[model samples]
Target: MRIAFYGSSLVSAYWNGAATYYRGLLRALADRGYAITFYEPDVYDRQKHRDIDPPDWCKVVVYEGTVEALKRVAAEAAKADIVVKASGVGFADDLLLQETMASAGPSTMKIFWDVDAPATLAELKAAPEHPLRRMLPSLDLVLTYGGGDPVVEDYRAIGARQCVPVYNAVDPQTHHPVPADPRFAADLAFLGNRLPDREARVEAFFVEPARRLWRRRFLLGGAGWHDKPLPPNVGYIGHVPTADHNAFNTTPSAVLNISRDSMAENGFSPATRVFEAAGAGACLITDAWEGIELFLTPGEEVLLARDGQDVVDLLAGLTPENASVIGERALRRVLAEHTYAHRASEVDRLFRNHARRVEAAE
Candidate 1:
């Protein structure tokens, strides 16, 4: 089967958090005998900051951000067995969604893959006239990055034909354990860009903890935080590239995962970094959220924190030996059940079942 995925950049992770998720899921699908063509717009300086060249597993088409270019790509995409319009392309999104849906043939399954289901659901709830809400009944399937049953139920309530959550998983080949680097050494480290929805939580889970524990080292990476005030103990390294993520994860005594407000509130939405850090054998401390244990065991494989005080307390009592034990356990768990290969198998099953049902109906 062939898939045409229209999403954020595949070659760049600059400001695009979905890059790794797309790569892992699609590469695994390719390995399972699916042909994929990723269509990404050449905007947001993504082309300038390309992380990886177009890989052999999938063809990537970087088109100019114009109506003519979009129309051409949409026409080409109509040939695929599946057409996916992922949320948050960050450029001409409404136009792209319209073109994708309008051009999809009857035989091609139309998918609205929501990388941020919580935010999208809120939008649909607030604005019933939203384009995606109107298109739900026509869509063959609604696949979410992650939101568990709540997301599926909400989509069903909004008249979606079908809804499924394809949670994020690590590509072990791309994010396995690496030798620790001194540059990323810290008692606790966090890697996330500064954004409105995420900033307050970052302050609660990361910044305030650093302030409370002035003696401990706290390293922060990701773009858009150069000017943000931080405790003297917290070091900021802006925009660590994808290549350095393994090192960043491995070197820290413990890595922190802070979800955006929407994701945390919605629960079951583990950010891609959660698996990436675990894949690199980093002891991870995540904020309290629903359905965390479904991914990683809280006390054994992962650590849970309710707020900055919990983070500070966890760091204060954590030892190198215990951190290593937790990290190793988390790594083993993810490798066994949460790798991209595992996810791809689930996706393959879903597609096959859906196809059989469609054929029977016909």
Candidate 2:
């Protein structure tokens, strides 16, 4: 099987949170004998802050920002068994989306993979005149990275032939626990970019807790958070590399998971960080969400924080033995059921089912 992704940037995690998910999923697909190609335009200064070099598992093609480039790639897109257009390509002009969708041949399947399900749905609902609205019905399938049942139903209502949720999962080999370094070790740590919508949640969950636990060391890492005021006890380390993510997760006594506003409102959506933290055997302190229990059993495998005070209490109350128990349980659960390899198998099944349906129609 040949799979291709038209996304923001495959090799850079600069301002993109989907890089880890893409790398893990595509690499797993390659391991399963699928040929993969990721098409990314030279936009967003991604070249300036390239993180991981292109791996041998998949071909990474960089296209220039021109009509000629799109024309040149149209044939390649038509040749793929599956071609996916992710929500935010960073440079996908109206013309580009139309051109790419039109280029798909009868044999090639096209999918609109929504990485930001909540935000995309909100935008489309709020603005009926959105460019992608009309394109929804033409795509063969719609896949979302997060957002559970409600998201899938809504997409179908909006005219998607088939809609599915492929939630984020961990890559066990890359995310397992490692020896912690003193520099990164902290009572609590959070790694996420600062966005306007998530500011209040960040303050409520991370900043407030740090303020209450004045004596405990707290670490905050990610881009666009440099100017955000923080409690004196909280350490701000901007933008940790993906390679060092496991070390960062392992170093923390407990890692914090804060959902974005849209995701929190949608319910049941867990980001890549949740699985990554668990994969690293780090005690996870996450804000309460409706569907969290489906992924990790609260109190048994993961700890839930309702607010800043809840976080403060957990930090003060948890013993080393209890934390270790929770971390180990979470790690075991993730390894058994939530690895990228498992997700790849799920994708393969979905593709096979689609193929069978197509054959029946023929």
Candidate 3:
């Protein structure tokens, strides 16, 4: 199938979390012999701060941030078997959405892949006048990166024909365990960008733990955290590249996973880091979530940390033997069930099902 994705910058992970998910899923689809084109607007200074360049796996079409550019891109999209308008594209102007939707012929399937389900749903609910709400019923399918039963049910209630959750998964080859370098090795390390909505959770789970364990070496990596006050023991390393993510994960005695407020509230939403950390055979200590056990077996595969005290206690008491055991179990579980290959197959099945239904109607 020839699929075209119209969303956020696929080649840039700079400050965009969705980039990892996009790259993994698209590469997996490409491996399965699907021709893919990713359409992205050259906005938000993404080109200036790109983390990963366009890979040979997919064709990348960059558009200017204007109606004319979007119309031009939509013309190309009209030929694709599937066209996806992903959530959080940063440049999804209402005019652009309308143009893209109208340009698709009967053969083209349009999808709205919501990478940030909580925020999107919340925004729509809060503002009945939201333009995307009007666009929802017209979309062929709605897919989300995270969220469980409640999310799907809600999407249906809002008039979507179908909604699927393609949870984040690991790329085993890229994220497997490696020898820990002394530079990245720490007693405890947390990696994530700073966002206002997630700041409180970060403070509770990571910053506070660092304060509690003053004598232990701690590291924080990701963009937008330079000005934040850090304890002397906690080192701030801004923007760790995707290439070095595995090394960073492996270097930590235990890696901390902190979810944003929206994700925690929605439940069942695991970030890409959870899988990445687990894949690297790094013991994971994550803040409590509603459906964590569905992804990782707590106590055996991961340690639950509800507060700073919990984090401190876990770090101080987790023996190397126990950590290794937990990491290995988590890695095994992820490899068995949560990889890009699995997600790609699921997507293919959905596309085939949709195709079958269309044929039946015809």
RMSD of each predicted structure? 0.9, 1.5, 1.3
Q: Give per-residue CA lDDT, model 3, range 1-362, as digits (tens).
A: 89878888887777788887888888998999999999999887777877777889999998898877888998887888888888877775566667777878887788888998987898888877777788889898999999999899888877788899999999886789998888797899888989988999999988888887788899999989999988999988898878888999998889999999999999989999999999999999999999999999999999998888999888888999999999999999999999999999999999988888888999
Q: Please give the RMSD of candidate 1 to the true structure.
A: 0.9
**Clashing pairs in model 1, backbone N/Cα/C closer than 3 A:** none
Candidate 2 residue-wise lDDT, 1-362, digit = tens: 78877887789888889988898898998999989998887876777788889989999998886778866765577777887888888764555667777777776678888889989998887766677778888888888998899998888877778888998999976788999977788899999999888889999999988888888999999998899889999999898888889999888789999999999999878999999999999999999988999899999999999888899889888888999999999999999999999999998888888778777887
lDDT of each: 0.93, 0.87, 0.88
List the candidate 3 regions with Cα displacement exceeding 4 Å.
none
Residue-by-residue lDDT tens digits, candidate 1, 1-362 = 89999999899999999999999999999999999999999888999999899999999999998889988897876788889999999778888888988888877788999999999999999998988899889998999989999999999999899999999999998998999999999999999988999999999999998988899999999989999999999999998888999999999999999999999999999999999999999999999999999999999999999999999989988999999999999999999999999999989998888778878888
**What TM-score goes with each of the models?**
0.98, 0.96, 0.97
The candidate 2 region of ten consecutive residues with least summed lDDT is 91-100
lDDT of 1: 0.93
Q: What's the true lDDT of residue 302 in model 2?
A: 94
Clashes of each: 0, 0, 0
Return the top candidate by lDDT: 1
Q: In terms of TM-score, which candidate is strongest?
A: 1
Candidate 2: how many backbone clashes?
A: 0
